[model samples]
Target: MCGIIGIVSHSAVNQELYDGLTVLQHRGQDAAGIVTSDGRHLCLRRKNGLVKEAFRTSSHMRKLKGKMGIGHVRYPTAGSSSQAEAQPFYVNSPYGISLAHNGNLTNSSSLQRELFEQDRRQINTESDSEVLLNIFAQELHHQNSYRVTPDDIFKAVAGVHKRCKGAYAVVAMITRDGIVGFRDPHGIRPLIYGARKTEGGIDYMLASESTSLVTQGYEVVRDIMPGEAIYITHDGEVHTKQCAENPTYNTCLFEYVYFARPDSVIDNVFVHKARMRMGHKLAEKVQNEWKDHDIDVVIPIPDTSRTSALEMAMTLGVSYREGFIKNRYIGRTFIMPGQKQRKKSVRQKLNPIDLEFKGKNVMLVDDSIVRGTTSKEIVQMVRDSGAKKVYFASASPPVRYPNIYGIDMPAANELIAHDRTEGEIAELMGVDRLIYQDLNDLKDSITEGNNELVEFDCSVFNGEYITGENKAYFDELQQKRADSSKKKKNKRAAVDMCNSQ
Candidate 1:
């Protein structure tokens, strides 16, 4: 997953874009980029690092000029971690468009071949965002209009919805025209637009989360609907159109379990509130199953799971304590590409508080267990800290299938809970008991917040791909992940040898 933001303001938006990206830094840590349009001239700056690292100096910010711009923080779910794949990808054709995109396209391989053979466009990197940019540019070119209007832009977006087969939330700047924002038909990813009234005129901003807009004093208008496209002219005029054939509002459930910030709202449901409901629902299961449970204290894994853990403690009538002190400097272990990197980072990322675990029947709560590397390690850490009994609870159900849209866990075997029963998983993790939230209860948790949300992209738990199940695609994805893992291992060995010399 990635974070994308775009702005059309009465003044220069370089600093605003930078600050917005900083707020969204949790969405991605690998790379960051920003592109600003000064009339017809586009100024670009992108690098393989966090937003603060990428735009470090005054000169970097000063170089970016314009009233409209787009920014991106990338976590590579589709491509390698090379600087060449860093985004805010630009194409000169179709009136000079610079685009930033979140979410992954499942049909990108076929689209890449189509672009080269049929569309006569060249793809520079392994990134699907580049292919998407070219597709949008090509579609706009088909419009054949010297003066592009909102209708032409909406038509181009419709062409994109017809061709692309996976999730995408895009924000593009068309040189002198304005900023455009659109969501995929399924709404598998989040995209919200808001407005801020300025002294000069009304300014508009679009981003992957509402936090990016609200933090900047922008009043959230609403989430850009499934299969909808919104165009904000350079003069602050707004126009929108439904671009997809038959759109459904199936937002990704993983966003509520993890990823999204607690303060953000998506599809009219508050994220933190949903997570609290998850804790309450999971608490019901615990109360029914383990009536005489001796959970001494409920301790959260830290950061993302804190809200749920606290609620779970309150519901279960157990004392809540902060057991893990997280190192804020460490990158998220879940998003790290390699298993070795993730394993190594867990210790550096979190340290167990001896007092919380010592001689107590400790119950640890985490958002969800994917690979189980971190969970197993944290369990061992709790044991090492003298815990008498260690129990674990997952706020969401087991991840049994691959998340093809945009998450990193592509191989089923990599998921500890994929083919294992609850008892088997508990044994493997060395926990005394393990409780996982039921899928139906998890759905109710979110639905309680917003009744309108009828479905979600819970493909990771149910193996039900909303786009359609393709065994060939799964096979290819597994092979790609295996190959990438080998390459990373070899590269690490080479680096270690060089350092020793």
Candidate 2:
């Protein structure tokens, strides 16, 4: 849900970090930050905006001049949008440490309560990053060490990992040595490392996505293994340690379906290839089910679904057309502020090209339909552009369940396809026919020879939650939601009674 990067080079690494963050800007647009270690001190700057808007002037980049640094672009998961919630969160005590993190921690509420009860440490922000920083600080204080070696760092992180549950990919900067990166045991999120070939020597770079590294002239080494930690010293010495003994690889499937850029790769699997496979599988299903009908053209919704559309076009033996032109200036419609704004934004976000759709029986390819709002708008747009008939093809199965893992999907009742049949959904969207990728088909697409290219966390699709070592935390979350709903109902009743009086 966020992007993180770190760099260690013989020369100043400000520019490299800046460019890497730019490549990762798509992962998050809410906030951007960077912390550079100048050996003597860590220069930090963070704000709520895009990378270009946040770091507008040369003076902003010049302030962070150091051989090693860490950067983050944040998408708010738990906390309210504010300057304090923005990351590269620093703790001054025990050797001035700054940390940036991606992914959500399910046990954070429990851990926060425990930390507050044990030690009178007031957490300033609601973000789990601050909780993580405080936990590391507490461990350092408990060990009572000043040297803060790599071993000490690993032990501190392991202690926090034992207490914490859920996903996290972290990058931290220390005053003395340099940058360190770590991924959660389940590997629900992604983190990769790259090395730039410099004139003097090699520079190490760590990022949430590989495209960032490629943009900054660094060749990707590999994805940082799940439950693994790597520390890149100021002198370019890379030290690694494993935090979790037997790690489960539960890479998020939504990343391939929607979140990640097509150019990025995760867990040794190319994102674009995975999407293409999904499209091909969908095409096969459609051919099997609706053999009588003819699909004249396969038209992509633009941007994210283009790769899948191309594969669908080839599979169906239909010509592929760029039917929709996306407005490059607007933010993503899904992440817009409100439903009203998102509905209005969708019109501005995409426009159907009349030449491509006129008199054509178009099959519109898209990744997924969450609430079906955007799909309905797009279907109407295509029909208005003179398409004879519109057939909608979703590359992924219907999202009938809620995504508790950081994706901002609404509750099950709010999902359009959750209760409605495919025929009903097709009528609601005003499409001639609608086809969704089957769940089994999606699973089959990613299967290789005795090995899956990526292990998927499809809890949202199947309603089968994979309980990790931290099963108790899942129970706690369910209970908490129940209590919150009860409390809201009670408050509403009280307010109504008072008004009646």
The model with the greatest lDDT is 1
Each prediction's TM-score against the native? Answer: 0.97, 0.90
Compared with the true structure, what per-residue lDDT tens digits does model 2 show for residues 1-501? 889999988888788888889889888888899989889887888887799988899999999988989999987643455666778999887788888888877767878887799965678776778888788777766767767778877887777668767778889888787787888877778999998777888899999999998988889998887788888888888888987767778877788788888888877777878888888888888788988877899998877888889998898888999888889888766544446777898999898889999999999999898878899999988889899999999988888765666665655665788877888889999999999989877765555311544567887787665434355654544443332443453355456446644
Candidate 2 lowest-lDDT run of ten: 477-486
Give the per-residue Cα lDDT of candidate 2 at 25.
88
